[model samples]
Target: MAQSDTVVRILDTAEALFAEKGFAETSLRAITSRAKVNLAAVNYHFGSKKALIQAVFARYLDPFCEEFNQELAILEKKSEVSLEELLEVLARCTISVPATKGSLSVFMRLLGLAYTQAQGHMRRYLQEHYGQTFLRFTNLLKLSSADLPDAERFWRIHFMLGAVVFTMSSLDALRDIALSDYDEKTRIADLVARLLPVVTAAMQAPVPEQPELVKQ
Candidate 1:
C-alpha cells in the first residue's frame, strides 16, 4: 500500500479499536493487525504508541475543529450574533462531518473516551492541539454574554460542555431507552436538532448567587 494509505488505515483501525476497547486496553499489535500493516509501518509513521493514539484523535478533531472555526469566522463577520446562533452553528458543524453511516457516533464515543480515560501524553496532546478551538468557543460565549460576571460565564460554559459531552457519549443508550419507553424514533440526524435547544438553554440558564456561609 502507498505510505499515505497505510497511515490512514492505521488511524482508522486504531480509532475503531480505541472506541471499542478503551485506549489503555488497545495495543499497537492489534492496530497493526487490523490495518494489515507491519509494526515498522506504525513506528515509521507515528514514532510511538502514544503518538499513534494522539494521531487517531487528531484525524477526526483537526478537520472538525477547522470546519467549526470556519463557521465561527463567518458568524463573526455578521453584524450581530446571539448565543443560540453560535451554538446552533456548533451543533450543525459536527453533524455535517462527512463520513459513512454511524461514523459521527464513533467519533463522539472516541471523544468521550479521550475525556474520561486518556492520560499523560495522550490527554495532553489533545488539550494542546484543540485547546484553541475550545478557547475560541468560550470567547464567543463571553462576547455573547458580556454583561454576565466572569464566574457566571465560566459556570454556564462548563455546564454546556457537560451537556454536549454526556449527550454525545450516551447517544446509543438514550436512543434505545427513548424507543422502548416512548416509541420515539431518535435517529442520529435528529440529535443535533435535539441537542441544540438543550445546550443553548444550559448556556442561557440563570446563575444563582452564592449564599454567604455563617462563621463556625
Candidate 2:
C-alpha cells in the first residue's frame, strides 16, 4: 500500500477506536493491527500516540474550520454580517456538511469523549490549536452585537453556542422530536432555517426607551 493510504487508514482506525474506547483504553498496537499497518507506520506518520489522536481530530476539525471561515468570508463580503448570517454559516459548516451517513455521529461521539476523557498534552493541544477557530468566531459575534453589555454578550453567546453544538450532536433525535416530516439529510438545512429566527429573537429583547423628563 502507498504511504499516504497507510496514513489515512491508521487515522480512520485510530479515530474509531479512540472514540469507542478512549485514550487510556486505546493502544497503538490495536490501531496498527486494525489498520493493517506496522508500528513503524504509526510512528512515521503521527510521531506518537498523542500526536496520532490529534491527527485524527485534525482530519475532521481542520476542514470544518476552513469551510466555516470561507463561508463567513463570503458573507462578510456580500453585506453586513448579521446574526442571521452567523447562524446560517454555523449550521451549514457544522451540522450540514458531513457527506456520508454516520460521519457526524462518529465525530460527535469522539469529540464528546475528547472533552471528558482526553487530558494532558491531548487536551492542551486541542484547546491551543483547534480552539483558535472559536476565538476568531467570537470576534465576529462582537462586531455583530456591539451594543450588548459584556456580561450579557458572554452568556447569550454561550447559551446560543451550547444549543447549536449539542443539537448538532443529537440532530437525529431532534428531527424525530421537532421535525418528524423530514429525513436527516434534509433536516439539517431545515433545522438551520427554522432555528435561525428563534435564536435571533432570543438575541433581541426590548431595550427600554429613555424616559423623557418634564422640564422643571
Candidate 3:
C-alpha cells in the first residue's frame, strides 16, 4: 500500500475504535490489529498513542473547522446576520457531514468522546490550527447577541456545545428507541432542524438579574 493509504487506514481504524471504546480504553495494539497494520507501521506513521489519538480527532475536526470557518467568513461579510442564521450554520456543520462524509455518526461519537475524555491535547492542537476561527465565532456571537453580558455569552456558548454534542451522540440510541417504540423515523436531518430553534433560544435568552436576598 502507498504510505498515504497506510496512514489513512490506521486513522480510520483508530477513529472507529476511539469512538466506540473512547480514548482511554482503546489501545494501539487494538488499532493495529483492526487496521491490519503492524505495530512497526503504527509507530512509524504515528510516534505514540497520544499522537494517534490526536490524528483520529484531526481527521474529523479539520474538515469541520475548515467548512465552518469558510461559512463564518462569508456570514461576517453580510451587512447583518440573524442569530438563527448563525445557529443554522452551526447545525448544518454537523448534519451536512453525513451527506458529504460517510462517517458523520462515527465522527459525532468521537466528538462526544472528546468532550468526556481528557481532550487537552486534541483540543489544544485544533485550537492552534483553528484559533482564529474560534475567535471569529466568539466575536460573531457577541455581535449577534449584543445584549448578553460577556459571562452569559461564554456560558451559553458552552451550553450550545453541550447540546450539540449530546444531540449528535445520542442520535443512534434515540433513533433506535423511536423506531422500536413508536415506529417513527427520526433522522439526523430532522433532528438538526428541530435543534436549531432550541440552540438559538438558548443563545438569545435574556441574562437574568441577580436576585436580592432577604435577611435570614
Candidate 4:
C-alpha cells in the first residue's frame, strides 16, 4: 500500500475501534491488526497511542471547526446573533461536514467517550489543539445570553454538550426505536431539527434562585 493509504487505513481502523472500545481500552496492536499493518507502521505514522487517538479526532474535528468558525464569522457580521440562530448555525455546520457513511455515530460516540473516559492526555490534547474554536463558541454563547450569570452560563453550556453527546452517541438506537415503535423513519437532519429547539429552550431557561441551606 502507498504511504497515504497506509495512514488512512490505520486512521479508519483506529477511529472505529476507539469509538467502539474507547481510547483507553483500544490497543495499538488491535488497531494495527485490524488495519492489516505492522506495529512499525502505527509508530511511524502516529508515534504513540495517544497521538493515534488525537489523530482519529482530528479527522472529524478539523473539518468541523473550520466550518463552525466560518459560520460564526458570518454571524458575527450581523447586528446581533440570537441564541436560536447561533445554535442553528452550529447544527447546520455539524450536519453539513462531509463524513464517510456511519461515521457520524462513530464520531459522536468517541466524543462522549472523550468526556466520560478518564484520559487526561486526550483531554489536554483536545484543549491544546481545539480550545480556541471552543472558546469562540462559548464567547458567542455568553454574548447571546448576556442576562445569565457567568456561572449559570457555564453550567448550561456543559448541560447542552451532555445532551448532545448522549443523544447523538445513541443515534442508531434511537432511530431504530423511532422506526419500530412509531413507524417513522428519521434522518439525522430531522433529529437535529427536533433537538435544537429543546436545547435552545433549556439554554434560555430562567435561572432558579438559590435556596438557603438548612442547619444540620
Candidate 5:
C-alpha cells in the first residue's frame, strides 16, 4: 500500500478501536497490528497516539460540522421557517447516511471518551469548536423564544442536543418496539416531525427553576 493508504488504514483501525475500547484501553501496537503497519509507520503518519485520536475525529467531525453549518445557513435564508423546521433539520443532519453506523456511532463514542477523559485537549476542542457553534445556536433559539434569559437558553440548547444525541445513538432499540410500519430509513423524517413539537414547546415557555434558600 502507498504511504497515504497506510496512514488512512491506521486511522480507520484506530478510530474503531478507540471508539469501542477507548484511548487508554487501545494501544499503539494493537492499532499497528490491525492496520498491518509497523510502529515506525504509525509514528511517521501520526507522530503520536493523541494525534491519531484527533485525526480519527477530524476524519468524521470536520465534514459533519461544515455540512451542518451550511444547512443552518440555508435554513436561515429561507423565508420565515418555523421552529419545528429548524429542529427537524438539526435532527436529520445527524443520520446523513443511515447505513453508515460507523460515522455516527464513532462520533458518539468520541463524545463519550471526551466526557470521561476530561482532558485539556477535549476541553479546548469543546470550548473553541463546539461551544462557538453552541452560542450561535442560542441566538437562533432567541429568534423563536426571544424572552428566555441567557442561563435558560444555554440549558435548553443542551437539552435539545441531549435529546438528539441520546435518541440518534439509541434509535435501533426504539425501533424494535415501534410500530411495524416504522423503519429508520423511511421514518426518521416522521420521527423528527413528531419530536419537533415536544422540543419546541419545551423551549417556548420560560424554564422554571427551583427556589434557592440559603443554607445556614
Candidate 6:
C-alpha cells in the first residue's frame, strides 16, 4: 500500500477503536492488529500513542474548525446575532463535516471520551491547536448572552457542552430507544434541531439571585 493509504487505514482503525474503547483502554497493539499494520509502522508514522490520539482528533476537528471559523466570520459581520442563531451556525458547521471513517456519533463519542477520560495530553493538544476557534465561539456566546454574569455563563456553557456530548455520544442508543419506545425515527439533524432550542433556552435563562446561607 502507499504511504498515505497506510496512514489513512491506521487512522480509520484508530478512530473507530478509540471511539469504542476510549483512549486508555485501547492499546497500540490492538490498533495495529485491527489496522493490519505493525508497531514499527505506527511508530514511524505517528512516533507515539499520544501523537496518534491527537492525529485521530485532528482528522475530524481540522475540517470542522475550518468550517466553523468561516461560519463564525459570516455571523460576525452581522450587527447582532441571537443565541439560537449562533448555536445554529455551530450545528450547521458540525453537521457539514464529512464523516469518512465513521458516523458523526462515533466522532462525538471520541470527543466525549477525550473530555471525560484522563487524557490530559489530548486536552492540551486540543487547547493548543483549537483554542482560538473555541475562544471565538465563546466570545460570540458571551456577546449573545450579555445578560448573564461571567460565572453563570461559564457554568451554563459547560452544562450545554455536557448535554451535547452526552446526547450526541449516545445518539445511536437514543435513536433506538425512540424507535422502540415511541415508534419514531430520529435523525442526527433532528436531534441537533431539538437540542439547539433547549440549550439556547438554558443559555438564556434568567440568572437567579444568590440566597443567604442559613446558620448551621
- Candidate 3 positional error at 199, Å: 1.0
User: lDDT tens string, model 3, 130-183?
Assistant: 788789888888888999888888899988888887777777777889899999
Off by over 4 Å in 3: 1-3, 98-102, 211-216
Worst 10 residues of 1 by lDDT: 97-106
What would the TM-scores of all predictions be? 0.85, 0.73, 0.87, 0.94, 0.77, 0.93
Select the stronger candidate by lDDT from 3 and 6. Answer: 6
lDDT of 6 by residue, 152-188 (tens): 9999999998898888878888999999999999877
Q: Over the stretch 1-216, how does candidate 4's per-residue lDDT look in tens digits? A: 334999999999999998887787889889989999999998988898988889889888988999999988888788888999999999898888888877888898898888889988888989999999988888888889999999999899989988988888888999999999999999999999999999999999999997899999
Overall local distance difference test of candidate 6? 0.90
Indicate the TM-score of model 5.
0.77
Model 1 segments beyond 4 Å from truth?
1-3, 211-216
Model 6 TM-score, all chains together: 0.93
Error at 97, model 2, angstroms? 4.2
lDDT of 3: 0.81
Model 2 residue-pair collision total? 0
Cα lDDT, all candidates:
0.81, 0.74, 0.81, 0.89, 0.70, 0.90
lDDT of 2 by residue, 61-97 (tens): 8778889877766765754678777776776787655
What's the CA RMSD of model 5 in angstroms? 3.8
- Give stretches of model 2 more than 4 Å off: 1-3, 75-79, 95-99, 118-120, 172-186, 198-216
- Candidate 6 lDDT at 157 equals 91
Model 4 global lDDT (CA atoms, 0 to 1): 0.89
lDDT assessment of candidate 1: 0.81
Clashing pairs in 4: none
